[model samples]
Target: MKILSLPSSIGLASKIAKNIGCGVADYKLTRFPDNEIYTKIDTPLDGEDVVVIGNTNTDSDIMSYLFLLDAAKEQNPKRLIALMPYFGYARQHRVYNRG
Candidate 1:
């Protein structure tokens, strides 16, 4: 098992990895000129379980998490998991009725 740590959730990722006794995966994240998110997985995740950790505190954070997941999936990991410690959504937990 491996954990892919996003910039905003590095600390949490480390804690989780330590607790789970799993290794942290190597990856790179950058931004484009237009402020787009870019993710690169340096370690191959073939046949490995992957955990992506991040926070959705802003638009970029959400995009970063999505892009990271996509990159991890491309490596063909056995399973993909998401750990969101901080989601900035105001009411995502509540179901809304038709307006």
Candidate 2:
């Protein structure tokens, strides 16, 4: 099994990997000159279970999550698991801004 994560969830991923005695995949995140996000997965995931963790706290974070997931998928892992600790898009009994 392999675990990957963004900055928002790296600590949690580390705790999980430590508890389960699994390996954590190394990756890099950076921004392009035009301010676009970039992700690079540095571990092999072929035929292994892959788990990605992140929080949707902001637009960049969501983008990072998507990029990480796409990067993982390209590796052709046996299964894909996504762990979203905080899904910020959800709303309850509160009035949203004027539409």
Candidate 3:
């Protein structure tokens, strides 16, 4: 299994990787002048199990996570696991009033 982490979750991911005695994958993220996101996975993940760690605190973070997930899926890994330390808006499970 391989571990991939976003900038926000690097620390946590490192700890997990150390505990599990696994190596972390290399990836790069860049932003364009127009505020677009780009992701490049440097490590090969073909037929390998992958775990992506990220936190969703804002719209940009969410977008980055989605892009990362899509990129990972494109690589056709054997299995994909998402570890979200913080998931936004997950507590609003009820609707008190309907419009």
lDDT of 3 at 66: 90
Give one digit per residue, the lDDT tens place, for model 2 in 1-99: 999988888899999999999999999898999999888898999999999999999888888899999999999999999999998776745677765
Estimate the overall C-alpha local distance difference test score of candidate 1.
Answer: 0.89
- Could you report the Cα RMSD, in angstroms, for every candidate shown? 2.7, 1.9, 1.6
- Candidate 1 residues 29-79, lDDT tens each? 988898777889999899999999989998878888899999999999999
10 residues in a row with least lDDT, candidate 2: 90-99
Q: Compare the candidates by lDDT and give the number of the best one.
A: 3
- Could you tell which candidate, 1 or 3, scores higher by lDDT? 3
- The segments of candidate 2 whose C-alpha lies over 4 angstroms from its true place after superposition are 92-98
The residue pairs found clashing in candidate 2 are: none
Please provide, for model 3 over 1-99, each residue's C-alpha lDDT reduced to its tens digit, 9 standing for 90 to 100. Answer: 899998999999999999999989999889999999999999999999999999998889999999998899899999999999999767668787876
Displacement of residue 67 (Cα, Å) in model 2 is: 0.5
* Residue 98 lDDT in candidate 2: 62
Q: Rank the models by lDDT, top first.
A: 3, 2, 1
Q: What is the TM-score of each candidate against the true structure?
A: 0.86, 0.91, 0.91
The global C-alpha lDDT for each of the candidates, from Candidate 1 onward, is 0.89, 0.91, 0.92
lDDT of 3 at 16: 95
- Candidate 3's C-alpha runs over 4 A off are 93-99
Alpha-carbon RMSD, candidate 1: 2.7
